[model samples]
Target: DQQVKQNSPSLSVQEGRISILNCDYTNSMFDYFLWYKKYPAEGPTFLISISSIKDKNEDGRFTVFLNKSAKHLSLHIVPSQPGDSAVYFCAAPFLTGNQFYFGTGTSLTVIP
Candidate 1:
């Protein structure tokens, strides 16, 4: 019943190391990829995004990589920090429908 899902439900990374979060979607026509970070008692915040045409998008320490042919999405965080510890979700809205697919959140723990 889920179109987008994270490879793992959780991840742990040492501080200052690169943390790679992976997501896969079943929809082949997905045009946009979105990464959101959420903390306790708060709504998901948009962290970064990329269009299907672009293979990669970077913003500061966060980078999103998209592989259309593989229907894969990845969020890379360089120099992971404790403050970066949170639940991350990958989402994409159907280009022609009202449905939006969201990945089962991946809880990331950036160990200090």
Candidate 2:
């Protein structure tokens, strides 16, 4: 079974604080990992990604770490902002072209 699990369905943090989102997967074939941020009524936008060959990737205030041996991954946001309040989805590339497997989602709320 292909299950990308985001056990915690939501998280809340105050502005200018750090926010961490977690994800786990059982499939080992997934080599490309990605994090997407979604706003209400809008499609998810790619945040960051790391190849299975790499353990960590970072972009500005967003960072993603992949632990292939443990089959786990996480997204970290430094100094979370009110504008960062939205749903985050973790995904991995599927064997099929242009296909992806996604976690249910985690809603992050940043208090102003």
The numbered model that scores best in lDDT is 1
lDDT of 1 by residue, 1-112 (tens): 8899897999999999999999999989889889999999999999999999899999999999999988898999998999999999999989664877899999999999
Candidate 1: the clashing residue pairs are none
User: Given candidate 1, what's the lDDT at residue 93?
Assistant: 84
What TM-score should be assigned to candidate 1?
A: 0.96
By TM-score, who's the top model here? 1
lDDT for predicted candidate 1 compared with the true structure: 0.94
Colliding pairs, model 2:
none
Task: Provide the overall lDDT of each model, using Cα atoms, as 2-decimal numbers.
Answer: 0.94, 0.93
List candidate 2 stretches off by more than 4 Å.
none
Q: Root-mean-square deviation of each candidate, in angstroms?
A: 1.1, 1.1
Give candidate 1's error at residue 5 in angstroms.
1.1
TM-score of each: 0.96, 0.94
RMSD of 2: 1.1
Instruction: Evaluate model 2: give its TM-score.
Output: 0.94
The deviation in Å at residue 64 for candidate 2 is 0.2
